[model samples]
Target chain A: MYKQNITKTPKAAALAICAFLALVTAACLLCLWHTGRSSGQLTAEVYLDGELLWRIPLDQVETPYTLEVPGPQGCCNRIEVRPGSIGVVWADCPDKLCVKQGFIDRPVLPIACLPNRLVIRLCPAKDSSASHAAPDAVTY
Target chain B: METKKLTFLALCATLSLALYAAESALPPLAPIPGFKLGLSNIVTLLLLRRYRPRDAALVLAVRILLSALLFGQPLSLLYSLAGGLASFAAMCLSGSILQKKLPLLIGAMGGLAHNGGQLLTALAVTATPGVLAYLPFLLPAGILTGMFTGLCAWLADRYLPRGPSS
Candidate 1:
């Protein structure tokens, strides 16, 4: 039926969209890993679809840092890390709005990129301290 | 035909400029870029039917410059000029080739062209190729808004007795 064909195409588009979104989500999740275990250095990894793209050391970095990465296919920020790890300091995208966002190192907080559909979250890693007195990153 | 067409173009330009100014009184639908009723297009579509390509282009030029003055933003000048010219050209070309009275098709093409032009201008201004990702995001909205504006223009053309026949 004509309807069947029509439905099939949307499914494909949806699948494509889903796949793209999943990649962004994975990137977000990957950027959230914890790299500190009493070493004073906080390490963060950036990924795309399970592929490791970056490993950064945030240890002894009491001040914020800015990391600019190249944007992906869509007009999206690549990555940025601000001084606080609380600010966005990474982005390859031209806008650099995300990178300008500054550091947001709290475990509960997150950063987002609309174009590349990428996101970065800060969460406790395997080596994460069970109960650090510091605030967890939380994004509203 | 020449004098009549010139008069018509001048009239459309003036009318659209006035409307453009008046529309500013209304609040924005959203804070995002490229959201408006584009009411000035009513004159553009009207001129399309009654005049030639050259005359229609003149109307577009006058309207764009006058509106830019009223809006007063050199930063947005590139976007407005490019978008307005592209949409006008699209409407003119499509009207000539398709030779169809169907307003919807004309409107759709105009909307698509406008968005393309805006995106191009944005890319140029920001010097960032990444903004292309937002193009897909804008298409559906452009189509819907284009159809609505086209319908308005069509209705105005059909029901509102011709304005003095130039």
Candidate 2:
């Protein structure tokens, strides 16, 4: 019967899907693994609509502090900065996704809010000691 | 089109819209902008198997447009439309590749494309290249959520009634 042929192919289809799912899962894990968890010193930079709003050296800050950054159309986000890390603790944006993102303690992908046009990125602290050296590192 | 087909399309569209609205009410699953369960695709996958491609596409478009009007911000609308179209195309291709037999692959591929589309839109709109870093997180979220939705659709397909041809 025609149905028999159709039935025979399902196993192969299921197997292919399983393989594909495994591949996607593995790729996801690999991506997370590569997020590059850079610990130690970090600099927290907040950008509003591509403009630098605030820069805090996490290494220098002794006390945890919070500030409000204004956005277009009366929107705003509240940022909390600690000695070694920073995060968006509150936002007036309807999605509230930035606040949900919580604190980022390491150098990884920035926490972004498309609606608020806000971004919080943590980068490895620059070496001020190398400021005067026009050395081999500058040419590469 | 026959009344039966039209009715089915309407029902699917309504189901999709319900899913869209329900999902909107939920808190963000992750911090990523475009990451969501994409549960509405369950209806899309089911329609793709039972009807012509055009019919399925019409339902999807209607759902996206109507949902945009009902509960979406302009920026979100833009992102959703971009992601919806990209994911729709991916699902269509994957559906054919899987011979409409495996909804999970279609869903997973659709999810991947959706994240890709949103990323491209985010990059273009903000002119910020750094957002590309989100790819690592979004890809996995899309695949996992897409597979879940696809699995649900596949099960529904087994028990749900097809068109009159059945």
Winner by TM-score: 2
| Error in Å for residue A52 of model 1 | 30
Error of 2 at B5 (Å): 1.3
Best by DockQ: 2
Give the CAPRI rating of model 2.
Answer: incorrect
Clashing pairs in 2: none
Question: lDDT for model 1, on a 0 to 1 scale?
Answer: 0.60
lDDT of 2 by residue, B81-165 (tens): 8888898898887787667877877888888888888888877886656667667788878888888888989898999866554
| lDDT (Cα, 0-100) at B111 in candidate 2 | 85
By lDDT, the best candidate is 2
* DockQ, every prediction: 0.03, 0.18
For A1-140, candidate 2 gives per-residue lDDT tens digits of 89986776766766776687678679766766555554567778788887777778899989998999888878888898998888898888998989888988766567898888898877667742222122221000
Interface RMSD of each: 13.5, 10.4
